[model samples]
Target: MSSLTVLVIDDEPNLVRSIQFSLNDQNIGLHAAYSGNEGIKTFTTLAPDVVLLDLGLPDQSGLDVLAQLKALSPDTPVIMISAHGDTRTAVKAVKEGALDYITKPFDIDELELLIKRCGEQQRLSKELRFLRSKQIHTQRIIGNSHNIQQLREMIEQIGNSAAKTILISGQSGTGKALIARSLHDIRFNDAPFIEINCAALPEQLIEAELFGAERGAYTGSVQKRDGLISLADNGTLFLDEIGEMPLAIQAKLLTFLENRVYRSIGGGKERKANVVVIAATNKDLKEAVDAGAFRADLYYRLNVVPISAPALSDRTSDIALLVNFFSEQFAKQEGCKPPIWSDDVISQLKTYPWPGNIRELKNLVERITILYPGQTAMPKHLPNEYKQNPASSRTEDSNYSSVVENKERELILSALSQCGGRKGLAAEQLGISRHALKRRIQRLHIDL
Candidate 1:
């Protein structure tokens, strides 16, 4: 919450004074240095949040000073200020790790905006580093089972390889998206990892969303849009529920995958995007292809580096670790002490068939953490379904089936209400598809 400090390194006294006066009432602390040496010394001592260095300095070359500053603190964001004609020097500074560069006589408002953006970037970078460090300490793939170990080894091998197109197949809630993210973060941490759920968007909008649109491409188009493909250039694009993508869009995506080129919805020029595509789906692509629901060519292309995320039921040995991880995570979020998981609770959890996989376990842990923080969790603390035998619980008791059906109905209704009756949003919240939700509604005979 402290005011962000900015260090300016420039020789022009008038310019420095003007900058200082301009930012005096802006709630930002400004420090000025007239030469490169003074700037480096002040930078080392003060450790400002952002630095504005002039490409032309009095004592030493600004590039050298920038290099030294980066060597000292690589995380600090440094913006270069140069004369209008010194574009070459600005480019050089940027190549040498400068965050960005601005020409002289820049608008004060624009400079302030740039400084704020730099500060936000610094904050996000710090948070990402913290998360990465924590992940290193705590395995992202948390399981000691042989299948899990082999899966982890495969992930590492694929991550280290140069495979661009990857296909991740698993059941719903088995952490396919997590595996996709892990693959992206492991290889390209500095780039964006954009995710798009194919089933979440309607057929009318998915194409525009993927390939972008011009101002007049559609009814609501008021401005030109850069789609996920363009935005994910030089990064990774995760296509979730890839089997649900419309057949028409599948062809376009296939073309893009083949050539890395795509055209906007209503544009003439072809745009290029150098991106890695990681597609995931719970449905079997082979089945979809055989049924003519998915393109065979696209499936072959994306299956270059296939990886399967194991279901939680298959990796029951990791139940305790995952429980602790989720419990501690939820406890931190709720500002409470983490719960102690008794052996009985772990055994109970290990026995339950997690139909929703890791996601279900995480939700259960969060629910328990919120309801019984700082207490020891035993088998009795679990939900009734988990406490009962899996097979007999569903088949033997009519009341139990009724209770589950009522719960399902309530969940569907709640999701629909929360989404303002938007079927796509409701389906996403319920972790199902719009078509599936329609079928459920018809089967339940729920009145809208």
Candidate 2:
């Protein structure tokens, strides 16, 4: 194991020197503090891997110190150092926050073992956080369209700013979550990225899951647990589908967003977490607020830096690029060579309005790669839904127009007729901006 940085808080110079001497062979960096205040100052600065806090301190009780340290960085492991007669207090320290305790007349070997255990556990957790980031790394936002370029610039600008709370608004499958991860990678790459879907968790349990709960706070509560906010200290906490969050929880969330302070369920000491909150939602928050389903105050608080994830139809030009990327990705994932995509298939894909966006596009590529590994993939091999949508057999009539132009006309008319000639609703179903739909209508010379 790598050397562990340990902060020892005790008044005994002789005992401190003894520990330093005994752990000399371990190559550890030891910081000594003879009093509680000194220990806190050093802890706030050092952020050592593990702490050996004395249960009895000269200036104040150690339990109070433990609570402060926990509020600052809950993930940091701490062990209690107590005298033989203070054994009961040591165990209570464990309940308070300490990972383990060693009564004085402590064996040096046992102390070394405890330190190593803490180091190993922390090493594992770091690895897990790295793996989570790695998974996001593989799913890069791939596109070169104007909207994508603007979105990229926005991420860089917002990431560089001091804004702590951001609201990501977009339709489902439009890569709102991807945009959130991109923002996280920009600023908090080294720190943990904790996320929770507010809509996925049960209404009864959402509060506890996000803010945590004290022991016996709920029916199944067995032990005190830290919330995602605490876990994401000095990092990013992604609240997905935030519009679906309950009204009561929205008020509590607003309090935390404003001050970076929160209280757990069953209410313990108010804890502070330095976390950048990135909230994503598919719902129209303004509409939801007006409808009395979402809190207005919370909505405004979270919208400090609003980000919109563009739908696929807004960047139809990038579909070919995305198709190539996904095909190569899924082919490698399936342990097979990527199938050759015909130009006809690419053209057909570009013509069809992708309502499900990139996610749907990715699924299509993955499915095709699995079924036809090395063969040439054509429009014929594609799903009938893809072929039947806009590119009907009538595109060949010379009196009509070019295949691409005819296809666009048909798609717009189909969407328009289905929505009873409502262009706004049709534009939504087509996954394009209202302006894009308007431009298409003018270009296609379609009658109302």
Candidate 3:
């Protein structure tokens, strides 16, 4: 592979020379520009993979230059350099689209790591853009509920740092992948998101899949291919269902996590992998560790920062929003009018134990939209399991009984009013016959 190029922008000639020399010693090509204007011109001409931008320039501010460069090439990653007291300025640069910011007189090692991360992020962003363009509909994390609000706050804090390892734990369908993707999009949208389901992979081939095989590492290895870890170098490798990773492989993973290095299967050379690993699992890894099924050391290595995806039950308030979101999404894909859901439908959705979480709810919405046309989703529109199980109707507040009764009464009134007070017509509109409507009305002792 060719050596990566880094462009350094600073008014101080001494700082520029030092950065250039240090980077060159590492065999990375370095270019320098003395002012923001020159830096933008050089950046445009050289198209360096990463830019170390000094926030203060003689002619123009670094933030202005960053804004211009971003406009020119949105995918390019910029790292702002600031003086000791200019931390606020550096932060403003980040908000203006810089990849990250570093303090003036930054450690050589830290600058190198930042440059490397920028390159990785750039590569990943290209891949994600491609994936997004191909996808039919992408689900976004949307909510102002306390749970969602807290998660967003944490994600913002995490994204501001260069932390590499993150563990996202939650029950199945609780949107672990969504959170992982959010993190990737926030910091490393410039890199390819390589996702692998550990639970789905065969244990025998898992190692080779992760670390790459050397054209004959084992049976069926016809070509030398880069492993996910290698492919995600400077990018994110999202390991879903990571708890299912075999114990033997966990040891190898730990080695890579510890040293940021790995040897390909059947290869003699040990290569450094600068990938950011984000592992997610539905199972309780602590319990697994206690049972001797999971390695505690590996768990700790991956859990540098732990994030929990809130379950559906934990954030029921978001269900109505989610349902509307998914309903419109499916409707657009299917080329139909977006379906609406009555409050009763939403109420039932909020009450059901979403064992499958957001994913399950999304699937249900899709199924309902596809199967029922020109109709709002109601209790009858739900699947048999949700409909038949009255136990699913329990809400946190038992006063929900009044809510259900109100819904029932509203439906009856709407049916009668829509049918112009004709019992037979109202019953038919309500999807029941006149006899059933009469019985329900009598049982509830409704005036109308």
Best by TM-score: 1
Q: Rank the candidates by lDDT, best first.
A: 1, 2, 3
Residue-wise lDDT of candidate 2 within 1-448, one digit each (tens)?
Answer: 6888999999999999999999999978888999999999999999899899988888999998999999988768788988889887886676566767888898999899778766654554454344345535323777668998788889889987888999999888999888888888878659999999998988888898888899999899999988898899999999999998999899889999889999999976899999999999989999999999999999899988999999888898777667766776775564444565666787788877787888988878876775555455778887666785664532433432254467668878998999999998886566445676787789778989
By lDDT, who's the top model here? 1
TM-score per prediction, in order, is 0.59, 0.57, 0.57
lDDT string for model 3 (1-448, tens) is 2467888889999998888877876767999999988888898899988888898899988888999999988868788899999997886676566767889778999888667755754554454444345422222675547998788778778866799899999999888888888888778647888999999989878898899989877988999978999888888899999999999999999999998899889999999988888999999999999999999999889888999999889999877667766765775565443444656777777767888889988977876665442254668867555664647543344453465567678888887888889998775555444665787688668996
lDDT of 3 at 304: 86
Where does the lowest 10-residue lDDT sum fall in candidate 2?
393-402
Question: lDDT: which is higher, 1 or 3?
Answer: 1
Clashing pairs in 3: 121-190, 123-191, 124-190, 124-191, 124-192, 125-189, 125-190, 125-191
Model 1 whole-model lDDT (C-alpha atoms): 0.82
Compared with the true structure, model 1 gives a TM-score of: 0.59
User: On residues 103-222, what C-alpha lDDT tens digit does candidate 1 reach at each position?
Assistant: 988999989877876775565445444544554412576666787778877877888789889999999989888788778877885998888999999998999889999999889999
- Give each model's clash number: 0, 0, 8
| lDDT of predicted model 3 | 0.79
Q: What's every prediction's RMSD, in angstroms?
A: 21.5, 28.3, 23.9
